[model samples]
Structures are given as structure tokens and as C-alpha cells.
Target: MSKYIPGNQKHLTLNDRIYIENELAKGTTFKDIAAFLCKDPTTISKEVRTHRLSDWYHKGTFYNAKNFCIHRYHCQKTNACGKILLCGIKCASCPTCNQTCKDFEKERCKRLDKAPYVCNGCTKKINHCTIAHKYYYNGRAADRKYRELLISSRSGINMTKHQLHQKDQIISPLIEQGQSPYQILTNHPELDMSVRSMYTYIDKGLLTARNIDLKRQAKFKPRKCHKTQITDRSVFTHRTYSDFCSLDLSSFVEMDTVHSSRESNKTLLTLFFTKEKLFLAFLLNRCTKGAVRLTFDRLEKRLGTYEFISVFENILTDRGSEFGDPVSLETGIQGIQRSSIYYCDPMRSGQKGAIEQAHTMLRMVLPKGTSFEFLTQWDVNLIVNHINSTPREILSGRTPYEVALETLGEDILKAFQLKPIEPDKVNLTPKLIRFNH
Candidate 1:
């Protein structure tokens, strides 16, 4: 008689989870990763599929759209929103199409349907692709998620939702103010719970004050601090100046932001096409990452994804924190590929010199210590149009508008309402555009 006895099964440890994460990135198969962890392939499969994060929110990097419909690239349906009669464009190109379109069919990656269900090991997704993309498993995040599930399922100290809310109102504020659990418990005897219970509630996110807020407070138990995870990878991983130099692109654009005086929150986001020396500037309300994203979103909307992808093939910029988030700029919210961003090394603003030269022209009009608060988008457009229409010696006595018309085509220029100004009528002064303020 053959004797086959199964070993005692144990839950996966944090170390095991970390190992799984590393292996998955190396394109290791589930069967191989399972063999090293001394667990069944099914166990690894379940752990990955169940805990794989969508949109990479924990990592601060959202992949292509989470609901990237497979038919988006090829589908010809229109006006899924149904708000307007005879919508101009197809719904497949819209980001919210999947949310409202009745004919939406989610395209699942065939590779994820099998063993390793996450994209950590994906070799094909090197660039900003249009496909619907998601499913990344971070070891620390998976462990945290698993612990929460285990603790919640254990059935200890089951307080009703109402009771939890009442406790949260009192505890969360004190916790936020850096009051230790021990101090709070001793002061508020009416809390009617052990110091450990307060810790548990904060740990499980049952309260408004998070576990992160407890770092400053005196704790009885050893609190292990986990750094906030923005993304599994760095923004400059493959987008350094060296990488930019490696590319033999026919054309490249340099981008930069010009900040106004402290009195005004508004800023100018500028783009200079090196090959043509064509310049475009956008007036932003505040110099923030979100504001920059909004500008990119608006520009992409005006010029469809295909045209945007072609024009902004590669964007070179400085290492400003405002451009820290690149996914939103590179991929449309609907998950379509648009452009790529590369950063120059720190203290190396001269790498993208064309934009620097273009800034000199800008300062001649607005100058330093100027407040952009009074300026409107229309005013900025007028200034840009005038600047683009002026003839330059470097362009062989041709204006940027004239050069752009031949190379980039008039369609993109027209979308932004860029027009020609007679060389005699060209103006580059503070009095160029009339501002409301």
C-alpha cells in the first residue's frame, strides 16, 4: 500500500508574500514560485488573484484605465452618454464609455486568466499602452490586506456600526492630536476598552485617524512603520535624460513651468518643440500636479489621442515635483496611450535649452515679480498667438506659426486657435493683451 501523507498546512507569512512579489516581477510561474514557498500552486494563484490591487492606487501609479474595454480601439459605437443627439465622436474613445455604454465588453488579459493573474511579470507592457491594464500584487499591501481580513473575520470585539461611529467621534480627534492610546484610555474611563482595542480599531481603519497618525504617540506595543507606497516603480525608472538621449526620435518637445509672484497662485506651463522651436504656454490656476494633469487632459481632449500621441511623442522636462505623476499625462483617463515624459537630471535645467530660450521671450512680456492672478486663459492665448506669429531670425525670417504649419500641420495650431499676425503688427509687450484684472 502506498502511503502519502500531506504536511500540516500553514498560512503564508509576510516573508512568503514578499518573495512571491519579487518572483512575480521576474516573470516566475506560479508553479515555480509555489515550489520555493513549499505551497500548492493553487494557493499562490488564489493569493495573487484575490489580493492583486487594481489601478495600483497603493503604489500611486494607475495603469491604463481599469475598465479598458477591449473594443475601445476598434469599436465604432457613439454617444453612450445619450445626453446629446448625434454625438460627434465614437463612445469607444471616451474614458467613461465602459461605465455607461450598454454594449461594453471588458477585455481581460488572457495571460492573467491562468497561473499568475497579475501584470507584474508582463514583458509586453513596456510602454504606455492603450489596453485596459491593472492587477499588480505588492507584498506589503497584500500582507496588510490579508491581516485586515483575518482580524475582521476572527469575530473579536464585535461592535455594531453605530457603536463604532460613536467611539470614532471621540477617539479619532484625540488620536489626530497625538494623544497616546494609553493616555486617552486613562483620561476617558467611559471609553470602556483596553488600550489594545483602540490600537486594533486604528489599525483596521475603523476610525478617521489612521495607523500612520499613531507614530508620534507613545505606544505600549512595538509599532512597525510601513512607508507609504506610491507606485511599485520610480517615475524616472526608464525616463532619465540618458534614456532620452538613446532615442532617435525625429522630433522632441521640451516642457517647463514658469511660476508667478507669491501674490498670485497662477503659473504658466510651457512646451517648446525643439525641431521647430514652436512654443505653447498654458495658464494654470495653481502650480500643482493636479493642475498640470488638468491641462494635459484638456489638450488631449481638443486634439484626439492619436494626434496627441504623434505630436507629443516624447516630452523632455526638468525634475520638478509638479511633473512627478506621468501616467495621467502619458495615458488618457480612458486608458488610451498618448505620450511619454522624460526628466533631466537634477540641477540640469540646460538639458532642455529650447524651452529656456522660449522662457526669455515670455519674461519680456510678463517679466519677473508679475502677478498672473489677473490673467485669464483668453489673455494667455492672445499672448501665445502673438508670440507664435512673430518672425524670428533663427527660423530663416519665418514665424513659429509658419514653421508649425508646414511640419506639425495647421490642424493642431488651429485647435488652440493659433493664428498668424502681420510681422509689422506683431507685439511682444505687457500691453499685448488686455487682462480683466
Candidate 2:
């Protein structure tokens, strides 16, 4: 803050104002003005000009307005030669011999002494005397505000496959928690999504990769149905899944093995509906006749032997021995005496199309190669219920629960022994379902 004296304004000027310039003419220094004006000594030094001489000022020591203007204009056009045609000349040369005035000005000024040269034939001296400052006016102003877009132009705004995979993992859970992609993107303002990409992520495993949350943690790919079928020498005369050529709903149940980390020593036997696309899973202590028989007994107890056989008129299984002695198991099941289990071809996995399709859905909950040595019967049943309850497009987008209700009526919905409770409430106290490799 500057203090104001009684009547001193910043713009104040008067003919009677202190003559600091006149004092300088008498050899008084700015140190003297600092004491007189009570201002910084630098202020007095700033007000004096080197271009002014005694005669060019008022009272032979103060500034004259006309001379100030003349000095300013002269400084501005100092490079202009007296020749009107040569006002903006690029090279300062004498017209007679093409020699630059800077190189021969000492001798040339003697010859043209009445003109503007400082000395004769002295290039260095003349070079030092010329107003040689070059002015450059940059046209475009510098950008002062810093900014950055998430996607860069040099990369063409395309994300790598790995980055897209990462993004899918992040966005999927938000969608499941009922958050819209638009809302998420609004907050982030950088993640871009197309309608196709959103659907693609949902269709993939992106929605259910986490063990405890709804977030999609990984990208999913559909499991391909193997082209080979199961073959058994003991069932040489038995019919194959190809014998029945119908795509009819409830006609077949696809079967596959869910192994434990216990190598092939223990496994879970999974069954899936062909047309209605329902799932049924059983944990077996061993992949033997007794184990398979016990699994069948449990199915009968849960779904009823009649309803189970009726829903799957035939069982389309792979070549695994866990489904061995179909006729004996059927006889013990106390239903049909004739055999109904059919094996896939020796190398063709596609023959058992129903169960083959089921494997893909099962992978979402229990991934392939997941060991079950420590899983419980209730855990296995919970997984089964989850699969059975999942909605399917083939079933008119109605869940298995809906189709099961439609088929068996609502009265039986609660009656099915395999119905699920909340996932966390599931009590699967690891019962070893062992199997022989």
C-alpha cells in the first residue's frame, strides 16, 4: 500500500514540480533526489533518458514535448536510408561498386561525407553504429491453458485388447448393481462404450467372474461342443444318441464330469436338460456303480423317478465310465427295465448335444478343471439349483424354475428336494466324492 501525501496524486504534474533533470545537469546524483522527494533513488534514475541533450529540453535541462516525439520517431525508423527508394533495403551496399557500406563505410563516408556514413572505409565501425535490431512478431499466440484427452490422436483412439478386457471387468459389475453405463461413464468421463460392446461383455463371462460379488472380473468365451461321442465295448449293441434324431424338448439330458483338484480321483456328475435347458448336479464319492447309483437315487428322491425319466426319456452321456452299467442302474432305479442311456461317439463330443451345451453354463459357476475334493453335497446341490433356475432363450427366456413350474405345476416347485436357498446359506461340508481315473 502506498501512502498519499496531503495533495499528491499519482498523475500530478506541474511546471513548478521539482527539477530533478536540471539537478543532473549540475552533476547532482539520484541519491540527492531520493532525499528530496522521499522516494526510492531508482525512481529518479528511471525518469532520466540517455538520448536527451541539454539543448533538446526546456530550461536547457528539462524534457521538451516536440523533441521527445522527434527522438521517438527517429529511433523507430533509425535503419531507414535517406534514399526513399531504399527505405527497407536488405543489404546496406554502395550502388557504385556493390560493396556493403558496413565493409567500406570509412572511405565511402569521406567521399559522401555530406551523407549519413559515420567514417571512411571502416566496415566494423559502421556496423556497430547501425540500428541493427530485428523485430519478429509471432502471429499465433501460445496456448496457456493445459489440457489432455484420455484418448490420444496419435494412437487413433483405439484401445488394445487387453485394455478392453480390463474395462469390461470394471463396467460389468456396475451394470449388474443396476448402474447404467451412461451413469458410470459420466462419472469417469473417459471410458467409451458402443451398444455392441456392452452386449458382448454381458454375453461373455464378464458378468459373474467374481466369487462373492456381481462384478464381471474376466472375459468369457463359449465352450465348443466336442465333435466326438463316447464309445463303450460293453454297450456295442446299445443305441447311440444319434439313434434318436429329434431336437425335441425334454428328450435328452447332457452329462459331463466335474473333477476335483484331487486329479480324476473325485468328481461331480452334472446333468442338463436338452430342450428346457435345466441343470442337475450330483457329487459322487466315487465314479463307480455304487456312486452313480447313489446319485441316481438322490435324483429320484428329489425329482421323483417317474418325473426324472419322463423329462429325459433318454440319457445322452459321454464315454466316461462313471455312467457305467446303465441297465443295472436303471433296474436298481426301479423304473423302466429296458436301457435308456446312450453314449457319445468314440471321438465325437457333439453327439451328446444337450449335456455338451450344459457344460458352458456350468463353467460360469464351476469352471472347468476345478477340483471338488473339498466340496459338500449341499454345495453341489446349490450349484445344481442355480443352473436349473437360470433363464434360457430356448425356454422362451423363462427360467428353468418357470418351465419346471409350467411342467410340474407350482405345487411341486417347493417339493423338489434340490431347490436353492441363498448362495451364502449353502452348507456344503466337503464330502469326498472319489472316482477312479
Candidate 3:
């Protein structure tokens, strides 16, 4: 705790990686880049040295591509090929000079030993420079490599199949009669695997023994869900739920996105006003950061800048990838300050109970296991209008539309295409929604 840290535990994003690549191309120092990124200089150096790609194309270097000796340019030696007669070619220009010469030594760039590890910003005809055993940092390629590593590291079994088969050969048959992994491991000292790993192997069907053979295991309840680290932690800087709590604002809206299916692309972006119990939703073609930002842009254009900010002073949401770019969402099109975006704690959906309740109401009209591919914005608006019209018990028998109208006025409700429906006309059933496609 006494040690001073340069940066938090936040992972470097693609943007940061791209910035590193750009700065490296500009011949920037590691210390300066690290300072700008708020990271330790070692981090920047390691990232470059690790992810930098190598290039060793044939004959790709300055003069004397074939002869790579350090003293080739100034050497006066000739007939190094051990020919009886002079080859007439200077030892420096000979293709086999480095191979045939006795005192030849491999030449390497010493500048790559310390900082600016790559040849990006060399300022010496970089594009046309002969590419030898040189290293370069590419933003997209580095990002791709990092993503592949991140995904592969978390998936698949740790043990090899041969070891797994061997372990299974020892542990399976004993359990065929009626022996738990723990009991079997207690008696067998030769087995190298752990009891928990054996249980997992059985659960994954990798072993002959099954979960049904175990005693008292069937009665155990499922374990509680674990929390995953939030994606793109940089976006949550100064925009955490703790920061939101510090404001103590009475009228904040919770935002979320609802997907249809793994195969379908259409989704719904929802916003729930906690004070009025008012719900608003927009149909999105894709559940992506760009799509969410575009939705906010369209809303601002429709409602105007000042009115949009007045309505959405603060937006509290989860750490989904769709909300990764809070900066774009918080900034208005006209370069003015509009709204503030905050993220809820990971795996804590209950933090935004108002939006969860709104989704529950939403599921009533569009239940699970149904396709939303045919849904249109108008169809979604109809569903939302009906949802807002229905009276909520929490609102003291007042509908969301009524509360919204009383507080935000009829003009504001009209801006969102919300209208009051008669008590008899309000339908919570799935039969109310009509698909366009």
C-alpha cells in the first residue's frame, strides 16, 4: 500500500494500442508514451517488444544485402572465397562474403536495444527501407493478437488428452460401482490428478464415470453466478456507480439493451425514469457501441440538445460492450455538454431495479424464445406506448404517461411518441404486438 502506482489495473484498449503504434511511428520515447497513457514505462516497452511483428524479407537491407558483416563497407579484403584467381568483386559486394570471409561478423542495429524498439519512426525512408530482421508495431495486428490470446487463455481444458485418458483409466472403473472421486483419490496414491478436476472431467463427459454415480452430489444446489471483470475499464473512469451516488440526484434514468436471440440482429435499447416509472425504448439494428451512440444522436436531433440534456441529466447503465464508449454518448453533436453516463457494478443487475422492472413489463408483450427479426420501430413504439399507458401499482394508480405528462408536460411526451391509452385499451398480452415483417 505504501508503493506509488503509475496506473490502475485497467487493460489497454484498441484505441490505446493504436495510439502507441502512431506514437512509435513518430519516433516517440517510451517514457513519454507511458506518461501520456498513465502507465508504467515497463508496460509500454513490454507491449512493444512482445507484440511487435518481425520482417526478414530476402535481400531487404541497405547496401550489400547478401553480405551482412559489420565491416563489409570498409573492408579491403578480396578473394575471400578462397579462389586461386581474384574474383574481381569487392569483398563488400560479394554475395558469399559473410559466408566465405574468415573475419566476418554479423551486423545488427544496436539502436533497437533500448527504446523505440521498432523501426516505425526511423525517419530514414521508412516505407522504402529494406526490411531485414526488423520489428514493427501494428495497431490492428497487435489488437487481433491480444484478443486471440485473451479468448484462448480462458477456454479449453488445461490437461492434455493423453494425461486425461490416463487419469480416466484409473478413476472411472472404481466409480462404476459406487465410489466418489474424493473416496477413490484417498485410496489411490499413484493418481496425479485432483478431486475437483476429476469431478469436472466427469461433468464434461470426458471420463466414463457420470454425475449420476456420485452420492449426495445430486442434492447440492447450483452455485451462485460469479462476476466477470468489466470490459473497457477506461470508460468507467470517474463514471462509476459510486460517482453517481455522490451526486444524490433524484431524477436519473437507468438505461439497458434487450437482445432477441443469438441469431437475430435486432435489439431494443431501453431507458427507465425512476421517479415517474416512465419507460422509453428504441429499436436498434445492432447491439453495438456505435449503434447506441447513433440512437442517442437521433434522440438528441429529435428532442433538441438542451431538452435532451434536461431529460437525461444522468444515465446509469451496466457494463455491457454496447455501452463501452460513454464519451461519445455524453458529448452532444454540437460539441456542447449534454448528459453524463455512469456504469453499474459488474454482475449487479439489481442496482438498476427500475429498468429491470421495465424489462419485465416488456417481456409480457414480447416473451422469451420469440423472434424479434420482424420488429420495426413503429411496432416497438406501439408496444412502448401501451406499456407506458398501463397504470403501475408503485405509481399510486397513476400511469407512467400520466406522471410523465404531469412532470415533463404533454409536449415532452409527444416528443417521444408516447400517448395515454384508455384503461380498457391497454394490453399486457403478447397478442397486442403486430410484426411488420
Candidate 4:
């Protein structure tokens, strides 16, 4: 039906399993060619039948040999079945047939990647992953720096919060040598650090508890008072006690004003005993001269004539408008013989230490900046009575009443005394009562 075609094995040689061409060129018939080449008769029959019209075999011989040589060469360069050889069959002389060929055999089932990661068991991670590397390095370094700063900054704190005595025990050595924070930080870089961190360390209980006596180092500056001058002569030093040495005892009574607050509705002007710890406080609607004279007159009338003269000699007051007018106050002390009042130096309050000390007593009952206007006279009376009955170290641990009785003898105590306070009525103080007088 159609032209017969030769197979690809047509290029095979005798050594390459006996090609049908060799048997056919030897004058063998198609049947004999197939038998000798161990191929089917149809294979040989196809090869000869395709060139049946070609009488001359010599013309095709050269091209046929050329093609056969090319085919053999190519076949020699490859493995069996025409696949490129990694190592040829004859390994001795062929350079391309060595073990170093491109297609050399390798172990195909082995692993080729890197090792597993440290976080192998992590639920959200994969083996040999590196996702946490950046975060680990960053967080680890930050935590280290934080700890170093937190611990090292504590060296800068200098103060302690302990008692004064314990503070002396712990800090005397440092204070005795006059150590400054700058010097300390220089010597020990950990100490005397940033001010914020030092305060933080103190708040966190990292510093010693002994209180430090950090002196208010003066900043070189001029005075900052608003009032340029006060022309009150009686508010200065010794003005109130100018004639104290010349006057007899109980003749001079120190007078001073006590305020709760500057804008308080009521005021306190208390009388003082310079010799003893006796005090009398009175409340006033206003700190005016009339209010003071009236309160003093009432006190004078309340005490008997003998006792009144014994306690009231002269009134020593400041330049306050309430007590500055000698004319108004002279009428108040009318029955006293030759009573001479004295004035304190202008703005010199310490000269009237007797009344200043009485102020301290009142501070116990009415603390600093307390509102006297809100308090009753009964409260002031209770404080006065407590101070009178309270035994004081300055009076040989005796109450003011006892001191007066001791000075005047038992006859004075028994005659006009209303009631002698029981020993259990008040607590005695071992320490000296701080009296400005």
C-alpha cells in the first residue's frame, strides 16, 4: 500500500548486535538477512524494498557509511538506550566517561537544608525558622540596659530618713568630712546620679532611712521683703522690758497678740507671767485698743485686790494699735500704783520673749494657723487651766500654782486658792518647757 521505511536500528553495526545491512551486503537474501541479524523478515524486507529501484549500491555507500559513523560516534558518547552517559562502559581510555561527569550519580534520599531552630516546640512556628532573632536580640539588650541603669542610679542618693540620733550614728562620718553630692558622684559614679532617679530611688525605699541634714545652701541674693520700712519704735528689741530691772516683781506683765489667721473673724490677745508659767488668754471681736483694755480690766477685777496688785505691775506691749495708746490703757490699770507700761522695738518680737513663749503654749492648744474665730472662750480657758496645772521642768517640775505657792509660802496657797489640782489631774513633763521668756 505504501513505501516501506527502515527503523532507527538501520545504523547498527555487526558488533552492535548484527545490523541487517551487513547480512544484506554479503549477498544474503531478505530471509537470510533477517535470520543472521536475528530480526524479523519484514524488517529486512522493509530496508531492501525501500531501495528496490536503486540498482547501484555503490553510490549510496559513502553517504551510508558517513551517516553510520556519525550515528556510532553519537551512540558511543551516550549511555545505553541513547541516554547521555555520566560514566561510559569502558572507563579506562575515555576522558568523558569518568566519575566526575556532569550526570554523576548522587544519593537522592538525603536532606539538604540546615538544622532545626531552638524554638522547635513552638506551636506557631516552623522548624529552622528565624522569625524571633531580631526581637530576641532587641529585647534582651533593652532589658540589660534597664537593669543596669536602675541598679547603678541608686549610688547617687545622699539623704536618709532615720531619727536624728541614728542619723548621727550613720552620717556623722560623712558630714564631719563635709561631703557633697558632686564629690561623691565623682568618687563613686553610682552615687549622686540624676536628680529624678535619686528621688525615685528614695521613693522606692532603696535609700537609707536616716534623715539627712541637707542645709539650705544660700543662693546669693538680696532681701525680698515688700514692706520697705515700719516706723514702730515699740516693736523692736528691749523696748518692752526697758525698765524691767528697775520694776518690782508682779508689776510688769508682758502683753502680746496671737492670731489664728490674718483674716480670721476673732482674735486672741493673751497676758503672760514673766517669772512663772502662768498665762491667761482672751478672745476679742477685733484686735482693737478698746477690746484689749476691756479684757485686761475684766481680768483685774476677777482677781482679788491683793492678788491683783501682786500680779499686775505694768503692761509691756508691742506697737500694735490695740495696745499702743497709753491713754486708754492707763484707765484700764487705774488702781495699780505707779504702773509704767513698756513698748517693744519696732519689728523686734524676740524682746518680748515672755509673751512669745506663752504663744508656744497656745500653739499646743491652737496650732499654728488655727482659726481662733471658730473656737470658743471656753476652749481658751481650758488651755489656760491646763498650762497652769501642768507641772513644768523650768518650775522645778512644779505647776505654776505650786511655784506661786512655794514663792509666797503655804499661807498664800491656803488663803485664797479655790482648789488644789490633784496629782493625777495632769501629766508632768520631764523636759524643759520651751519658754521664750
Which 10 consecutive residues of model 2 have the lowest summed lDDT? 137-146
Listing every candidate in turn, what is its Cα RMSD in Å to the true structure after a full C-alpha superposition? 23.8, 35.1, 8.7, 44.5
lDDT tens digits, residues 176-204, model 1?
78788999899989879998888888877
- For candidate 2, the per-residue lDDT at 412 reads 49
- lDDT on C-alpha atoms for all candidate structures: 0.79, 0.50, 0.82, 0.50
Highest lDDT: give the candidate number. 3
| Window of ten residues with lowest summed lDDT in model 1 | 1-10
Better of 1 and 3 by TM-score: 3
Model 1: colliding residue pairs: 59-230, 59-231, 60-230
> Candidate 3: what lDDT?
0.82
lDDT of 4 by residue, 1-437 (tens): 11111122333233422343333334445566556555676754443433222111122222222121212223343443334546455322243333433443322111111111112122333333222121111223333454566589865435565532443343335533666434444555544355454334434545442123223223335565431232445344343455554555553578877766755847887877667656767788766656766765665566644555565556676677566545545543565442346776567778778778777766765666666666676555556666678777887887877776665455533433323456575422312122211
What's the TM-score of each model vs. the native?
A: 0.47, 0.40, 0.59, 0.39
Model 1, which residues run further than 4 Å from truth? 1-233, 434-437
Q: What is the lDDT of candidate 4?
A: 0.50
* Most TM-score-accurate candidate: 3
Clashes of each: 3, 30, 0, 24
Per-residue alpha-carbon lDDT of model 2 for 235-282, expressed as tens digits?
635456556444343356677776665464566777766655667777
Ranking by TM-score: 3, 1, 2, 4
Question: What range of 10 consecutive residues in model 4 has the weakest lDDT sum?
Answer: 108-117
Tell me the TM-score of model 3.
Answer: 0.59
